[model samples]
Target chain A: MSILVIAEHDNAELKGATLNTIAAAKAVGGDIDVLVAGSGCGAVAEAAAKVEGVSKVLVADNAAYEHQLAENVAKLVGDLGKNYSHIMAPATTTGKNMLPRAAALLDVQPISDIIAVESPDTFKRPIYAGNVIATVQSSDAIKVASVRTTAFDPVAAEGGSAAVETVDIVDDAAVSKFVGEELAESDRPELTAARVVISGGRGMQNGENFEMLNKVADKLGAAVGASRAAVDAGFVPNDMQVGQTGKIVAPDLYIAVGISGAIQHLAGMKDSKVIVAINKDEEAPIFSVADYGLVADLFDAVPELEAKL
Target chain B: MKVLVAVKRVVDYNVKVRPKADGSDVDIANVKMSINPFCEIAVEEAVRLKEKGVVSEIVAVSMGPKQCQEQIRTALALGADRGIQVETDAELQPLAVAKCLKAIVEKEEPQLVILGKQSIDGDNNQTGQMLAALTGMGQGTFASEVNVEEGSVKVTREIDGGLQTVELQLPAVVTTDLRLNEPRYASLPNIMKAKKKPLDVTNPDELGVDIAPRTKTLKVEPPAERQAGIKVGDVAELVEKLKNEAKVI
Candidate 1:
């Protein structure tokens, strides 16, 4: 059996989530091939070739793949589906959009956001907003899945060298057109890929108060995140939300400031290596998962921590 | 133009559910049920469109046991012109749900089909995309903002890095995200009026679709619980643990 990992990347560089997806592919135990489907993404393919355990990297460069549109990319993966036993990608928005369409085209069932691989056919995944974990077994010939990248440790970016192969691009589907994109600009690391993240909640009161988190985060060189409460309260943008309905992160160190730690929020960051929760309310659920709990006003603790650091 | 919206009934988000002792499935014996949050957003977006005069009619659909009719009625109370219940006692997978929705689409011939990105119960995030592929229509998933224009629609999607805007031709599929809109509650009068709204019931077999589950649940289990750690008396001790033991800083 062979595995095909769809590499998540921009035309210039690969995203960090792809490395953890490669780890999941390695766990599946097979000759893993990485597919880089994007316009002018040869650099990404070159980087994929250096990743440990990858046997080959396939690069499909064409204008049709510039934005990684689902209709076009799904067709690209579906037409090449016969070569591999398992096709997986990081459970990002792009992967979620493209893989299911490919699965439908292949006439197979696609498993979503799998956290563990018990066997080639059976896998473990979270359901009902991570309240229950379900073990599911697929009976289809081709197993299609999206790996929750936070659950797996990322493979090394360099070690062994794999060969690169250029492949032909699929036909463009003229159904949808990419109008434009608006990405959040940040000097700090991406939220999901950060080593240390300091997050604020509704207790921040307003958007200006997030500057407190930004200050401490800057001192520690960490990412700034927010709970769904903060985002809903207009204290931060929706992209910064960390929860079951939002982006999941498992950084090495996570500091929760003024966050009550709702169940939905815990589902996203409870897996961090070391968690420090500073909330005024000792009864906050965030304390349950935290390694170091401090019952202090975030208003005082944050600035003090920033000055100390 | 007409809009077809798909809603799902699931356990309320506030409830902390757990797997049964035998590892068979989640125990949902007596839990408060509500519309999937994302589905609520979908319903709200469609209703807004109808109120804007862009949509002439709104048809809501749900696939589940007879109890799901309550959710369909909820959709009606929210502003759906009518409702269709694809009644089935058996649990259906994403593909089966897509096939069933496709059959309804063929008969209703709505210009736009809107659905939640994924239900909170399964989190599969596939039915809308699969239904789009099955019906040979364009799809814009994870929509944060939707705008209806002449013969097409523009959707601003929430991707990993940021927001991406795409324009799809008519007769397309669009899924809702949390940031799309705040769902309004059904007023007492609207709830009363919804009781008289037309809601038709049918089965998957009648729709020429199979409702059998594609994936089997081998087992269900609770995730490993995190143990509560000791509280640090002061910042000095917290900093000490981070530097000496955790070494994260």
Candidate 2:
């Protein structure tokens, strides 16, 4: 049986989540292949071919594939669906957007954000926002699933390389016309790719108060994040939100700032390698699960810590 | 312009989840159900469009059992002009839902179709994109902002790195993001008025569409619990432990 993994990247650097997804796909039944669809993503496909267990890299290079629009990708992938036993992607926004459509086109069930893969056809995923796990089994010939990257470690690329094939498919994606793109400007790490993430909450007070978080976050090359509370309070944009309804993160270090660890928020970063909480109210629920708790005015402590870093 | 907004019924966002013995689904029998949060955003966006005079009729559509009627009523209460229920007890796959919706679009011909980025229940953000594909229309997923201009709609989409805005021609599909708009609760007057709104009930068979569920549930269970890690006392100690012990810093 052959497995197809959809690559997550910008035609240059690959997200670590893709490697984690690769690891998960490898553990499951099948010979592995990675599909990189973009305009002139040769470098990306080459890099992906080196990932451990990947037997081949399929490249679909065309201007129409540039957007990664779910409609077009789903159609193309689904059209090629007959060749693979299972098609999987990371449970990031893009994967979540594309997989279901492809599954639908294949006239099969598509499992989302799978947390555990037992056999080739059986998988476990979260329902009710990480509260309960649901095990899904596909009797269909080709099973489609989105892998939760947090559940697996990123695989290192082995020395062997794989062949790259160009896929020719008509672009059925008539979605939105091309428009302007404004990238989030930041000096620190990107949230998903960051090794460390420091997230603040409503307890931070106002926008200016986030300076306290930036200090500590900068020292560690960490990305600054905000709880839904902080984002709702207009302390930051929604892009910075880290919670169950927000972004699921697995950073090496997750520092929660002035945040009570609500279950919703914890659901997002609970898989982090290490989590630290700094809050004045020691009784705040964040302390219960925090690996480290600091009960002090973040105002004083953050600056002090910044100077040391 | 006529609009169609898709919604899903799910466990209330605040409800804590527990898995059933069979591991096929969550123990949802006792939990309160509400409109999926993202679908709520889609409803809010459509309502705003109506308020802007960009939309004339707002038709809410959902595919599921008779129980999903409550979600339709909830949408009606939130200012949707009407509701359409495609009766089916099966968990319709995204592609099937898209096919069913394509049938609806062919029949209703709504100028715009709005949906949540993904259902909180399935967390599959595929229906809208798939619908666009099945119907051969434009698509904009995970929209944070949507502007209805002359003949085209401009949508700002949320991405991992940042945001990207695109423009689409009419008869398009747009899925909502968390930042799109805050959903408004139906006022008492509107809730009372919703009782008089038109709610058409039809079976999926009537739509002449095959919406057979393609995937089956083997079981449902709680995730493996993580052993509580140790908690250090102070900031200095915490930093030291992180650097020296966890070795993550």
Candidate 3:
């Protein structure tokens, strides 16, 4: 089977999630083609060509796609994906924004986020905020799905030598225009790609209290996250939220501080290889999944832990 | 300008859903049901726009079994001027639902359409974008802030790295994110008034949209449980375990 895997990238570099999506595409057992659609994204296409298991890289470079607006990108994917057996993209904000629109253009029902590929036709995904896993089989002629990058191990980034081809498909649906963006400046790491992540919850109390977690995170070179409660309490921005409705992260080590271990929070981080929970309440549900549970006040233990590390 | 908002009825956010013993699907029988939280935010945004006089009328829509009308009523109480229910018993996938919404958009000719970014139950996160595709409208998904202008709307979207602002022409689609706004509670008098609001029921057949399942559920199962591990006595011991045993650090 031939699979079209959309590469998640900005104009300059490819995101790590695309490699994980390529891994998922490998699991589907197909000749994979990576689509890098953006303005001045030749570097991204070259990087995609180096990814292991990719057979070809298709670059659609144009001003209309510079911002990767869903209006233009979805039309591009829909028109080009007609030749493929399966179309997949990483379940990031960009993927979530455009893939379904493309699927509708194809008159196919697209699967949201698949964690496992049981087969080419059947896949497993989380429903009800990861409380239940559902195995669904598609009967449509073409299968469209979004891969949960955290569920799959990333493929090697620099091994393959695929041919890069430039496609001259320019879809400038003038319905939308790019204004601007405000990206968070961070020195540590991207939360989803980080090897280690330390997150805080409502017990962090205020935005300033995230400093404690930041100190610990800095020691470990880890990314800092927060629970939905913390974000809802206005202690942190919504981008820092780790929960069913927010970002899903799976690191080598996940540390939860002052979080009550709500099911929604667990849904995002339960896939971590090792979990550590630090809370004052021993009865917090977080203890149920933590590999190492520390029943202590985070205010004292976090500082002490940073010093010890 | 008129606004079209879509709402969904699903199991309450607090309810821990479990699959049936036969693995057919999630058992929602007799479970507490409520409007999906993100959809509530969409309703609130529409009400706020109406309160600002940028929107002349609000049309709330939902598609499901008969009971979905409760969610429509909730939207009315929140501030929608009218309600429409595309009643159906067939499984409503995102594509089919988008098609139905597209049909309504054609007839109503609303200037703006809003929906939750994702439903709590299915969590598909597809309807708004797909509707935009089918209707040939611009889309702004995961919107944290929305500003309706003279001929277009500016939306601040919550992307992976940070926030992005985009301007969409008139008759655009927007999906609500978590930080959009806090939804206000419906009072008793509003609930009574909502019961009298115009809620017209139409079927998928009437809209000329085919509601069919393109996928089949092979099974439903619980995620592998993570076994609880040992509790550390102090911070020093915890660090030692990580360096010596786990080696994660």
Q: Which one is best on TM-score?
A: 3
Off by over 4 Å in 1: none
Candidate 2 displacement at residue B33 in angstroms: 1.9
Query: Which CAPRI quality tier does the interface of model 3 achieve?
Result: high
Instruction: Write out the backbone clash pairs for model 1.
Output: none
TM-score of each prediction: 0.98, 0.94, 0.99
Scored by Cα lDDT, where does model 2 land? 0.83
Q: Sorted by lDDT, highest first, which candidate order results?
A: 3, 1, 2
Which residue pairs clash within candidate 2? Answer: A104-B95, A175-B138, A175-B139, B23-B219, B23-B220, B24-B219, B24-B220
Report per-candidate DockQ: 0.82, 0.61, 0.92
lDDT by residue (B116-193, candidate 1, tens digit) is 999888889999999988887889999999999998999999998689999999899999989999999999999999
What would the per-residue lDDT of candidate 3 be over residues B155-227, giving only the tens digit for each residue?
9999998999999999999999999999999999999999999999999999999988999888998889899
DockQ preference between candidates 1 and 3, better one? 3
Over the stretch B1-249, how does candidate 2's per-residue lDDT look in tens digits?
999999888888877778667655667797898999899899899999999999999999988899889999899999999999998887687777888889999999999999988777766667887787677777788899999988889999887767888788888989998888999989999998898999998877898888766677777777667555565565677767877888986
Candidate 3 ranges with C-alpha deviation above 4 Å: none
Clashing pairs in 3: none
Interface RMSD, Å, model 1: 1.0
Alpha carbon lDDT at A199, candidate 2: 90
| lDDT-superior candidate, 2 or 3 | 3
